[model samples]
Target chain A: MEQGIQIVSILIAGVIFYGGVGWLLDRWLGTMFWTPCGIIVGTALGVYWVVKKYGQAR
Target chain B: MGGFLIPLEGEWVSPGVHSFDSRPLFPGVLPDWVNGHLAQAVIGAALVIGFWLWVSRRQQIVPTKRQFVGEWLYDFVRNNISREALGPDYRKYHPYLLALFSFILVNNLFGEFFVFMFPTFSKIGYAYGLAVASWVLYNAAGIKRDGFGHYMKKMTLPEGVPIYMAWLIIPLEFLSNFIVRPFTLALRLFANLFAGHLVILVFVLGGTYLLTLKDNLFYNFSGGVSILFSFAIFALEIFIGALQAYIFTVLTAQYVHSSISEEH
Candidate 1:
């Protein structure tokens, strides 16, 4: 249950961060470029690095 | 069946349309009022289909003006997304990806045409289907690139990490990369389009609500402003809908690119 919660929590943050950045970039630059995609890949990689070393060990 | 009940005075029920307020508006179930979303979807689909049918029937290589416009948009997606993201092999994927992008772009923009203002992408199911298609392509491409064993390992392992870190990293990596990423893609598109539709709905509905107030000077003034704001939002929605579709397709293509790249 706790693990499930963690996964969901990570997802909420990912949505806000990725969607927020993409939206801001679109509003500012008036183009749908890599900002949204970058946020997704970046956050995905960051969590993978963090959890692989710390969370899974437990 | 759920088709028999239409409240003529208050609530109208339809397959895809729902009211914003969540109240049981149980009265006006007229065909004209209850099925707004489906009506819009049909009209939108018909317009695209009609345009294509007409264009294809009269297509020419000598550069008629209509053909030029069609070819321009077709080439835009092909070159920008298919060629750029997938490289030289993009020709094989161009048809599917191009259709996906244009279908979404048209459906999203269709909301601007009338009082029936629902962008099809705002429906989560459509976004989910599109996302799953991209997900399948990415994983399939990965498997094809590295073979099954290597693909799995590459996805779960980061380069230069300590061997002991595998315990923590693998699950997190697997979950984020393999499981949730596609869902986020779908939700992001769905939520943005959905919110945009909702804002338009509020503005239009606000105008209607204000106009319904007693026939006084203040009511008319407020109602006029509400109508103006709604029109402004409708215009913004046209741009936003196309932009969201473009963003969704480009990101999907990029994901496929990353999957097959040597850096992975």
Candidate 2:
């Protein structure tokens, strides 16, 4: 349960943080693609993060 | 089943978020903010302290019942949580982990037991308070052990990442480690206990309403089932309460362990 919460928080946090940034950029540039870009990048980064922290031989 | 739940003169009301409200213990005699939760919190803390003190004061090498119970609790926290997480440096943080686990366990059990019958952490503010304390504790321990510059660098910058990616990695790490860690920590505990208590209230209140107010015999049987099933809910609540307390304490130890470890 604890590991599940950790993974979910990282994923959700990444989305929210980058998505908010993308949203601000979209408002400034008057474009819709930035939000999607931000979300994808955020999710990838979140996955990479989990892999880095947990995928290694400890 | 209680008359007080149905009220004296008003129409029967269903259990809702209003059930979680912390009304003043004495309406006009004292401050309006002096509610049952505050009193109960104090009592919980007092009981934790008193129990540990009483149990630990007269420890027998052979171990009496009190000594055995105290030793078991302490060993579980110290070994299973602290030592398991913090490695050799677990001793210093053992006291905090023990206290936090015991206090939270007591407060969560308040929902199932008599007198209070309310889980204290259901209040988001209180949960946030504990989270903040934990945030301060882990950060303080990390900075103290690794120095400010070293600790910040370790937290925001994972090894083997290129310097060019620092712009992206820095903010992400900062947000995750500094912001989201404690946020999720508190919310997990609060949400579990809050939802569990709400579930119980639904069963108990709806059951009571069905049994007493309705004229039909079917409603009475269903109400009896609901009330009986609430015992299962109560058991589930107790399990959840203990689990939340354990998770909260384990996460705390994890944060501190990660912070103070030789590696980032």
DockQ of each: 0.05, 0.49
User: What is the CA-based DockQ of model 2?
Assistant: 0.49
lDDT of each: 0.69, 0.87
Worst 10 residues of 2 chain B by lDDT: B1-10
Per-residue alpha-carbon lDDT of model 1 for B1-264, expressed as tens digits?
133322222332322246432222233564443344545556666776776666566776697888887788888998878888788878766776776787778888766775554577687776887889888988998899899998888777767678886664565566666667688778888888888878776766665555555557687578669888888888888888888888778777766776787763
For candidate 2, write residues B93-121 as lDDT tens digits. 99999999999999999999999999999
Q: Which 10 residues in a row give candidate 1 chain B its minimum summed lDDT?
A: B1-10
Q: What docking grade does candidate 2 earn?
A: acceptable
Model 2 lDDT per residue over A1-58, tens place? 4456557767777887888899999999999999989989898888887776667786
State the TM-score of candidate 2 restricted to chain B. Answer: 0.95
Candidate 2 lDDT for residue B172: 78
- Name the TM-score of candidate 1: 0.69
* Model 1 spans > 4 angstroms off: A1-58, B1-17, B20-61
